[model samples]
Target: MSIPPPLQLLLACLAVFSCRHFVASHQESGDWHCDPDDEARIAAEFRPGIVTLDGRADDWSNVDGFEFPLRPALDPDEDHQYKSGKMTVKALHDGKDVYFTLQVDGDYVYSKGDDHKCPSVALMFQIGDSATYHNMGGCKESSNTCNSTNCRGYEVDIMHFSIGNSIPGRLYGGNSVNSVGLVDMYSWNPHCRNIDASAPSGNDSTALNDWKGAWWHSSFSTHPGFIEDDSPYGSSAEKGIYYFEFSRPLRTTDLLQQDAQFSIGKSSKFSAAFWYPSDGNPWHGSAHYTISCDWIPMDVISGLTSQHKAASGNAASLFAFVLSTAAFCVSIFVAYMVSKNKSIPFTPIDDRL
Candidate 1:
């Protein structure tokens, strides 16, 4: 019943012969099998907060990949008040459809009604900050902030705009004093007093209006990938996700749908940025925030694996475990061929009896 050590080693090597087949099957099947209920639960977990465990690597910072340690690490707005955390994400696919859930949480959420009166905080969950073209806010110079390829995306703003303060492109939005009934220590500026009211973005399309308690959502799609676009200044109209938040009742929610809606076999990392104020702390008032995500890939046209096996409808992780595997295989093949020269071909003796 037991195979010898030598035979076991021989069998272990047989795995190499089937690499191509495994790769093909894996590309089609995605991850293991899963029931529908499991998929729905995974989607629901990430929907309640402000985070991006579903987007490209650059969505957090100019960072090329999604490694938790590399994120901006949610520092205080300054070295003073709030704390934030790095975003973490995991995604999978099942070959038929895809779904993702994300969350961003902190000790305390900044009030939207506060509006940046004078030196008020500029809060937002903007996409494309990873690239220069998509990073531009209202006051930044240049329309498309990037010299490289431009990106088209959206953003969600949650800040304190007011009469006492002035943002680059907003008037009533930059000031939040007097509107939320704050102390009137300063002179009574004769301007709008409803900067941070619990309402939709001034009944407009801009993100600043949809202010929630402090969180918001804006889904992006079919835009340029970070792999192709990387700029420092932040671009405009390239492609990103941004949307203002509205007043929260008992609960709030949002969903993202891909425009082209295609999934890859390789495992893609997801990350996000959540910057807030940590009033009193050390390490430059470093803020500690928590973000999480779950994702499922869609199998609309292609099979779960390259061999075309049905993934039994179970969701497979987004990082389908393909790229690194292929690379390693290629390397091994090259090495073997090099070691065995064609000049040293094996010849059989002719038996002339």
Candidate 2:
């Protein structure tokens, strides 16, 4: 039994990526292995197969400045195209930390785009807080959307996955450059109306570009000074394992905790909600904005893609397989009963005339 060089090559490539693919040549009729006429999933458009994400923690939370009590969500999908990994979360008195245990499929393709340097994921943390902070262009106020203004809060202070920043794929400031956080407008001063109500809305006018480029213009003369600019936060950075620590001061649990949003290429459409409780030093003096993020090696597509497969594809297929198997047995039983009734034994009757 000698394996051909081509077959050997294929196996070697598989070894480079993930050995857990379970991609046996025994799919379908199983003639796809050595029949020379076999056509199967592994044989069709399969290049060691790139992996995505599956499995998530059913529930997780953190209390004020208390240690996070979380159970890592292991890669439960053993035979999945992409295997999931473990995630650990904890909250500290001043900030939070999240750690992910990832071993990429090794077959995943490096992302391509303008931000080609880093692979990133956008993020959004709940909305409708009692107040929204607008931190942009050296200012930290409260608002949802900004107008050409590069404010501090307009951009959140977070990290994510697959971003284009220079981080050698999965490291600091690498991914999590998504634009999920909200952006809003603010005036020169703290006053809500520092902006003129009669200002035009086009970038063509030199005057307009100079004065109204607060939300976006890179070099507006009147734009606030650039110091510790937070353009990464409020954007899509939710793909990483967010190590949320600290509980809110009071138990106003009725309020929405996290209205996280995610978007691709500056368009904010992908995201979900994240909720936890209030914990941390109640008398830590000031509620300083503190957050931490680590884009551990990205092993698979997480968040949305994961939710879809788990809730739709995998669950439905397994359910159907079991149902059909049961139905087939029931049909065989009925056929046997019918044949038995027609073949009942009886004594022969002899008629004499």
Candidates' C-alpha lDDT:
0.25, 0.23
Error of 2 at 349 (Å): 9.7
lDDT for 13 (candidate 1): 36
TM-score, per-candidate, Cα-based = 0.24, 0.20
- Deviation (Å) of 45 in candidate 2: 22
What's the TM for model 1? 0.24
After superposition, candidate 2 runs with Cα above 4 Å error:
1-305, 344-353
Error of 1 at 3 (Å): 71
Give the range where candidate 2 is weakest over 10 consecutive residues by summed lDDT.
205-214
